[model samples]
Target: MSGLPAFRPEALEQWLPRTLQNHYVDLLLRRIGMTRRRADCFVRLALYLFLKNCQSRKELPKPPLTELSFPQGWVECSCLEAADVFYSDRDRGGDRAAGMMLNKLVDLGLIQKQFDGNCTQVKFHAMPDLLKSDAKNLHISFAIDAFDPRSDAIPIANLLANNYNWLNRNNDAVTYRIANILRDWASQYTAGLRVLRRSDNQNPVGFYAFYPTKRESEVKFFEPPSRGLHLSQVADVDPFQMALAGDETCRSLFVRSWVIDSDYRQAAQMELLLDAQQTMKKMQQDFPNLWDMYTLIIHPSYAELSLALGFQKTNADPKMPLYWMYQAVDRFLKLDMQNLMRDAQSLN
Candidate 1:
């Protein structure tokens, strides 16, 4: 876990903006599982140094006398200073704390290091792709039903509040609004919600709430105010637009909320899709007029996955932060179910 001592420059603080460093550190912490507080501090300091020194430079400076192998990119830091700054004990146990953290990080494939005299050279491994399957096995279960505001609403609200950090709403306000919306959906009988849970512990991990509508008036509460003209109200001469204007023939389902927890995100997404497919099949059987489904996707990863699953970008404003993606019900149903199984195999 120790590395050869390379050149230690004096001014490393000005290398990166504080905001960028904090963002990178937050992302790294979320991605990896680190338990000990001292280890976490050491890792953060090492990451800061690595980002400031190694990643910012196009090429690393020349190493000292000894020839060393840096398979991944590396940064040189004074061991004593790093320990004093990051570890709890500055005098006696700082070095040991730093060593323990570095070794743990190495074991986790996050970094590599070498020890030389009194200094340590640490190399940062590149973050692996999101689709790269980890060894942890995931077992997700699905449930689809009409929304029950009294019981299901609170849990669903809590799930979204916990998982969707981008949403800026107070917990109580979010829960209240979600409950009211669910109550409205339940009363209308035109919408349903799906919940995904871990099979082993039966804990909820994901949710998808949707409502079918053919005209703007049918969508009572959750209609976006920015959508000035509903599909039925458009006076455009386009044949497709005209077709969608039909009273009951061209129904569209609006996705109100869709989210999955971080740990089960990969496996649970496909499960949610499959669950949606089944739910759509039931909706089609009961309603017999549903045509397509649409959702505003905020996360880049979810947008990419949506595109991979045959969703198309809608004609909504391109400048918007969230992308509006749509998929025909038939096409969605036609997507290869075997792919889900293949993807789940990787999870196991």
Candidate 2:
């Protein structure tokens, strides 16, 4: 095993400059969240899309390429839909075939579904993590709707700074300007999306609002067919128990943070975790098709607290900084309060 943990290609790009052609190659490595040859394929796909301004070579959504368009020299439209592309690659597994190539982008927060019914129109949002702070005001909003179908590419500075704010340090003008130059070079060379932001004050602090994107998969647990089969087998399981069953349908749980007073961070997070487990357990007890519950990663800064609560890490990647963790829903309820209190020492 290598000393350095593996990263997906998309995650790798996050480490490099914000604006650079072939940014996806590095990111692709990060997205797979592992070291593998397929990461190379991700890079090639990025290159192909960069040159053609299309995501796929054959004009087919198959392999669902995101960064580039297709070559003008190509004649046939392939007329093939994403479903066909998925089925054709069924050996890779339907989910992997239809969605694997693009899943990394979603996981990295580079792309998201606009959620139009059935026709499958995916809109990409690029924003920088930049938060401008000053004595008077803080500008913490992204340049929205930057991606256009007709445009050949997005500005590198805009994409990098847009999606990633960790690059921006409070009110440092020099770093921000240098970041712009790097963005320009990336726009000219690479083909990937970014998140953008701009703040008013030169140096500001505390409480900037942000809208981070979430990944959506077509796979949902409550859907027909399998629901009936699984519901009967696990009728009495607790939400935590159901989540551990590990069925495809259980993967659709959506998680988001709720705003509360400053003093409530610890309490609020705990409550939310409990609610999420209860929600999954409810579905498990009431719904037949549901199996395992899907959970989101806790924010990195808060992870130590979650671990103390008995959440086991399911993902490991240095580039991600954040991680997703899980525990049996039923097991969660039986956790000893004393143990939780003892482990809480880490926070002190």
Candidate 3:
């Protein structure tokens, strides 16, 4: 490692002027979705792992190629060394920042890391390069429409139970149970939205399900319930729990689920957020009583995303790794989502 990049700040600085502008930045924005500055930080670490991993892949049998494949990868390094690669000495504090970035990268599906004694084993999974034909197209690449429970239920059930992408972050078993319960309570969903891939493949890629409720019931979501209404313990809002009929009054929304394919989320989130904003407008137009939205989050990636979108974690449970998150309709509308998401690579 003498002549090559050796996980040092100076070593990485040498290539930044040339490589960071093109290859690294574009991929981080297109594949990982980050602000230029944050992408710059992530790219440095990515380059170090990628190049060093390449040096070690000389004899290993290459795996079959696919969408999110890296031709040469995997490296084991001390947390301190990774810290040096990600942040300069002036800004980084030993291994703490390194650990945070590593967790974020793993959550983003950029790299998979496992702790091994004092060091970490890192495996690079290149984000899919399927956008080559229209590489310059920055528009939302997927389509969205009202989620049809009849056709999308099975797919939603499958995603909730079987998607390796989400299950990896949250436990596989927890989601499997959640999937079944979500299916059983499908009728409880007041509004649902589904995502579709571009071109001819019409299979559903993701969905966002919601439950509208009256203020009396909405209070439990903002406050910690004694029984603790985690996603696993959530129940349907009975007819009495429904908000009173109004010609055009404000009502609250309980987010049942916001599941998007891991592949589609990195690129489509901004557009989807914009779509959601419009959807709220339409919902308010129809319901006239659309108030605020809230939900319990167990998935780490979704938690980070909900945080970035301005969802505040209520005093639900300090001991638990999960809790309820809340956001008002007006607050979401007031947000500059495009700007908020640019630097949200870490949160995403």
Candidate 4:
């Protein structure tokens, strides 16, 4: 009761996700591969969860990809109880609607679940205990760059530790996570750079992992995020590639992470996008064989964002959540990027 907020609809209106009331939200969500119905369902659920967070007096998690600062982890509850709550139309016994939503959300990289043999734990991609202080007063900001673990490891580890309590809470655990990131990044076959952040040039905030790979490699190793580790699968998409197995050359690239923190919204986001864009743009200089780009989007924002960047879904079904997208390098370079720098105030 102490940490929770009063449940008043109008009073809590500000906290609701746009998807609940905005038809445009679902329309945008559809660009990432959801059918209109599924998108509507997801937004309703998102709004429901937001209300729950308020009833519990929890803070809002940062927006996915764009507003991403840190992954604070999930809310823990039994599967049965969660299902009942998620689908309010249920009788004393809930129907399977919750399960279907769970599968789709997992496929989209929006949430994570862990089974404890007794009860299941759920971690929303962005949900919270509320920020104790105003983000405006925090005075923290990030600059993305080619990741260098040697110089950037400690601060980055500390940043991850501060927000994600589910982490092992030790130096070794952070190291292990870094190792996993490297393994995922290694799959890229094209010329690419691993992205990291420098917070005020001292700390690290979020990971917008980027990798390079061949199309054949992606088809061979591309695993749906719902089936494996989220971090691995989130940035697991590579854009293009070059050279085939034997006596054959190929031109395609797969991007493991084309993450753009949309919380920053248009202007700020384009700046971040340019950082990665420049890297990919440079990859073209030495390796002219580069062409297509591919990714299994991690966040719903990424779906439309990718679409805006000139990507098209491959084997996409509106009724289904899972999707792989492709874009040609020739077209990507054509986007106007006149506004490519962000105001320092957003760091707060």
Candidate 5:
């Protein structure tokens, strides 16, 4: 035990998003039908253990095999200690709460676990499959659409509520503000929103919302004040202004909000990216001035995906939680279109 790395509970609490923490709890309760208390404790403790392992991996000089295979890998920890930290009763029904929760998570196909002597090794297996399935479902028709506020409002609102509620935990103020922004964009015909709906029920599973801007003032209309600090740290002058500066011939499309439900996240992300590429093409044709795309990405997973798609972070602040990333539209458009077409064909 002395040779193995120690778990840091504080790091897990600090790095994990409140929205994601709640999401895990909701998933366990809805999927496995666990009681609220048990589900909360189970998810909290399990995620802490998982993140602790991830932190340990980061400290190592070489990457773990699981990291190579999965986007978010797994961790191994002491089941007894995990239970002692999360549950009041160290033993629940003679099996212990940690053991019972681990069993339930394994049964639900959310995690894979193996006993290695006294320690338990666990890994996540859902996100990769979700991503592949989403990519398979991509179609040109669903890539971009004219958003209808009347019919699309409820589902879009629900999606936003689930993903961004942590920003304003006290009420639905964030949801309302976002709804108003979407309505404004739809009404003005200045922007569009792409939604990915479930195949069976047609309920929206994910969405990507964005709008174009030519002036620095326009950036403020899209982003909240809380995000301004990160943007300020990244640029001595206004970053958005700098991107648009001396480019009288082009405009920047600001990616305001993007999210996918936990169950279909990876697939939704692929679909969203595919749709965004198509949308860019359409925007280029309709609005020839559209020359670049920029966004302030807060989530690490989103930042990783954006970087993979050729977005470069502008901010030099090593400590900033958010990233201001951008990509030139015209320079990459031709190659991007070719790749997108190839990807679409492969999916077919």
Candidate 6:
């Protein structure tokens, strides 16, 4: 039998690009190392609803349009409610096993979750992977104002290869797994990559994974991290974006598998870090409510380089288990009142 009408006639093809539709079908069959058909169906359902309400030329709304109104019959049958309906329709299975499929969809960048007031709403963007077409080399560009030499900002593949080599040699299976997880996770957030070649002799390095510091704040974890020892509270984080922590606490912007050629290691890595830091600060400056800067993770191969650059380890765990470091820039500058207070105290 033909598949049930997944969406209203107007939305079926309009919601997803032809390339994305083909990609989704491929992802369903192979699972991209993690996805499923049911989840794909659910995402399709979300796509239908989102297209029915949202216009795709603009960015997908983080919380979706707050004013959105769902048709009564549509709401009752919506895939946004799929989790509830799917679980109830089937026997209660293991925790999250039901939503495991949804998680995979999120991993693949087909859907995202957002909080609207007290209720949670999911938004679907059927955009294909931003960094498609793996190549032997790539060239990446960064914000002109934010460029630096000592940053963990490079193509994802280079980052992965560096980490994979380091972890494999060290026999750290966990780090390897975490690296894999992060690669997949970053894929969802990537916007686009444009290759900019430096030299014909040198192969293109890799594409930049642009995480717009302004577009990621609503993600649950980006909330101000706890004021733990060694952790500094920052006040300039961009509203739309913050880095992902290797650990669950979200204190560090985990940088995994970052590799550059031996010759350019110092220049390339440092440039990326400095750029990321400056860009982050600029974001924070624009959005005073957000924090300024966070730590990063690199392969142990870069540990010596990081230490030389003043990145200290927060833990002694030999596993080197994604260590956390901290950095902060003073958010408040002395104003007339503070200067007056300082003057009075100094006189006393």
Go through the candidates in order and give each one's C-alpha lDDT.
Answer: 0.52, 0.32, 0.59, 0.47, 0.54, 0.37
Residue 8 displacement in candidate 3 (angstroms): 4.6
**Ranked candidates (TM-score, high to low):** 3, 1, 5, 4, 6, 2
Best by TM-score: 3
- 1-348, model 3: which lDDT tens digit per residue? 334444366755453444433455566665433445455555666556555665576432232212222434457766777667666646535678778777777775667888767667877664435334235334545777766556666666666554333423455355545555555455554343444444346677777756566666656675543333434433443322444335244377777667666656665666677877877776676567676787777566576678778989876665655577778888987889877776675442
Q: Write the per-residue lDDT of candidate 6 for residues 1-348, one digit (tens) a residue.
A: 012243443334454554565455443332222224453455455554554343323434442222222221222123334444234345553335535555545544445655555544455552322213111223532222212222223333344455445334543343344334334434543322222223543343432333323323423223332311110112233233333322123222322223444333322443444444444454343345443333344333344334433445553333443454433333221113223322322320
Which candidate number maximizes lDDT? Answer: 3
TM-score of each: 0.51, 0.27, 0.72, 0.47, 0.51, 0.31
Q: Which TM-score value belongs to model 3?
A: 0.72
Provide C-alpha RMSD values for all models, in order. Answer: 14.9, 20.9, 5.6, 10.7, 14.8, 21.7
Candidate 5 global TM-score: 0.51
What is the overall TM-score of model 4 with all chains considered together? 0.47
| Residue 267 lDDT, candidate 5, scale 0-100 | 33
Report, for all candidates in order, the number of backbone clashes.
6, 64, 5, 29, 0, 27
Model 6 misses residue 105 by how many Å?
A: 44
Q: Give the residue spans of candidate 6 off by over 4 A.
A: 1-155, 169-257, 266-270, 285-287, 292-298, 318-322, 329-348
Compose the digit string of candidate 5's lDDT tens values, residues 108-183: 4456778878667777776445434434554422233556687776778767666543334444254565566567
Model 5 stretches with alpha carbons more than 4 Å out: 2-144, 166-172, 216-250, 316-320, 335-348
lDDT of 4: 0.47
- Candidates ranked by lDDT, best first? 3, 5, 1, 4, 6, 2
**Error in Å for residue 230 of model 5:** 13
At residue 14, give the lDDT of candidate 2: 40
1 against 6, candidate with superior TM-score: 1
lDDT of 6: 0.37
| Model 1 C-alpha lDDT per residue in residues 229-254, reported as the tens digit of each score | 22112223311121122246547776
